[model samples]
Target: MSTGAFSDTGLFVCFEGGEGGGKSTQSRLLQQWLEADGHEVVLTFEPGDTEVGKRIRQIVLSPETGELSNRTEVLLYAADKAEHVDTVVLPALRAGRVVITDRYVDSALAYQGAGRTEAVAEVEAVNRWATRDLRPHLTVVLDLAPQAGLGRFEERDRIEGESLEFHQRVREAFLAMAAADPDHYLVVDARGSIEEIHAVIRARVAAMLVTA
Candidate 1:
């Protein structure tokens, strides 16, 4: 496992958690704030960032694709990440842009590892290699219970349609990963108001900016 620093001139921040945790909302908010502060920001997401990734995303998320094997699903996600980093993420980071992602490798670790009952360590290894060992400067996990989070979604995707037990495992996996790396993670309770969550996120990123 390669746990090292990312680009010195650029910041790669990833938002992670179970479904309907408001990761997209927070990622966009952070991007807007960074841009307003005169920083070049790239807002992106995994499993659908690039042209190839779009097709991969459709296959992975569509319920019609039905009953994929665990290994096959993991490979599809890894493929998306490989193409995403090569085309969208790495270039933006190289250009000294603040890359704010809605989801990253951690999603794979939590969803595939825990939800599918696979080895978490192996999942992490695959994702790390898929992303070329790129580590986010900060990973913000919007922690919420599976029942409440899933209830917020009117329509569920293939993964979201999973059993509540699966989602609970996924949530625990995310929390465990965050707990293992506190310095690199900000675990926020998602029950808070949108503005309240953004405020805490802003404070953390502000502290990083001062030191960066």
Candidate 2:
């Protein structure tokens, strides 16, 4: 059995993928749709939602900062997750609020772990420790080819500016994870119409609602 923990009181949904995968749009759509369905939803994102996380975001995403040690980047992300879960995610989930996050530990595992060539086990261990091993109830992977996704972004961040091979690795990592955990993951083709994608996500999430 999987050792990761989940909320008994509230749903925890996460959106993950490569760059330009429309995580923000889909997460917002889910949040709005759930709220219309009468859920108290908290929409947030990783590495930048909390105040401390904002600074970490700059360090990790800023192109001017250039190259950073892979381990340092992992630890920085871990710190943000620590603060985000402790102050934001856990409190809301405890009060029976559905939490929709644009990204989470999986992003760290895909980006820092696979993209940067860091050992996946070591990276996962750090992130699990940071978030106290809390796993999302559902992770929607917006699947898209790295080349196609990267082409959508006009301005590339530090991570986005990586070579195509790096992004290909990241894409493979996300798909591989979803394949390994079919019960908890939904792999949505990101090229579909926005409404079509949102409807698919809504249907899955609606089925998971116990009292809604």
Candidate 3:
């Protein structure tokens, strides 16, 4: 399978996993580390990074919205991806800034595709087009049991409140994708100490920087 398009001007890294897998923490740490090294870095997230995406994120993540059609959810997420790429991601990357995203196309494929039991191929196609086929140079998957991850959160979003089985499927989806593309992925045991996990991620990113 194709790895999709990667930027030639800048580095693109993404963090992926089930809910509460410390994607935010790791993404922040990576951004800080990159900035400290004198690299211009842009930290962003999907479904709400742009003005238009914020509304889409509210409708998709808010419990008050109740259930939506599985296909509807995919398109909403895709719309956010479209807006985000056009308004934020592409701009930074073209400017040679490191772009670290909390989640990207993989999240939609795992959560809306596998978690919701939607057609994975269809989800991938929509997202590929949504982001203009932009792919991260490296994706860090924080491997963790769904139970452990869910317990980390006191409050739940709509997606977070999903059943254990649902999250299990999502977790599997991330692993399967990573396994298929080892060169573009790093799977981390999220149960490790925060600093340890960050060290592992930084080491991998460090190597990529030598080439970047």
Candidate 4:
């Protein structure tokens, strides 16, 4: 479908998942696939592409800090998101590019909103204000067992080092979000081979474009 036919310049799609889930890999594949199909594409990630974002990313992801309070952590993530939306996502959408984010507002919703400290409603409320009600056209959630996902995260450096219970909360939060918004979200089993997962994502994107 030519974006020229639609009133909007481009589409917004987000890939969301817990640590160890194949979000990064799948996000890359989707961006490549979209570009191959002739759509202009912008690939961005949370902890984002801005200078403030980079500083915030180092602070949040570093385990060197003894213990970060839940609300503080939540607010930090939200701050990063607000800057990211202002500087990255909104512009790409306005310019008619398919914007693929490795993580988005939903990550804060899951990891910090419902899972870590703040109330889900409060987290979402702040996000709504920050984004000015902007949302993804499709959110592909990579679902896997929390333990399985965290296991994959252990080798990497970062907050995936959090307690198992904390990660479980993250998974539960993601599931709840998907359950509540079946129309805009699709849950994909991410326990499979990379190729298989990418194939599923490609099919979904194709169908969504057709229907759009």
Clash pairs of candidate 4?
A: none
Off by over 4 Å in 1: none
For lDDT, the strongest prediction is 3
Q: Could you say which candidate leads in TM-score? A: 3
The local distance difference test score of each candidate is 0.92, 0.93, 0.94, 0.81
Stretches of candidate 2 above 4 Å error?
Answer: 210-212
Please write out the lDDT profile of model 3 over residues 1-212, one tens digit for every residue: 45588899989999999987899999999999999999999999987998899999999999999989999999999999999999899999999999999999999999999999999999999999999999999999999999999998999999999899999999999999999999999999999999999999999999999976
lDDT of 1 by residue, 2-101 (tens): 5755777689999999988999999999988998999999999988989999999999999999999999999999999999988888899999999999
Clashing pairs in 3: none
TM-score of each: 0.97, 0.97, 0.98, 0.91
- Local accuracy of candidate 4 as per-residue lDDT tens digits, 148-198: 886764365456876778778888888888898887788999998999999
Supply the global lDDT for candidate 1.
0.92
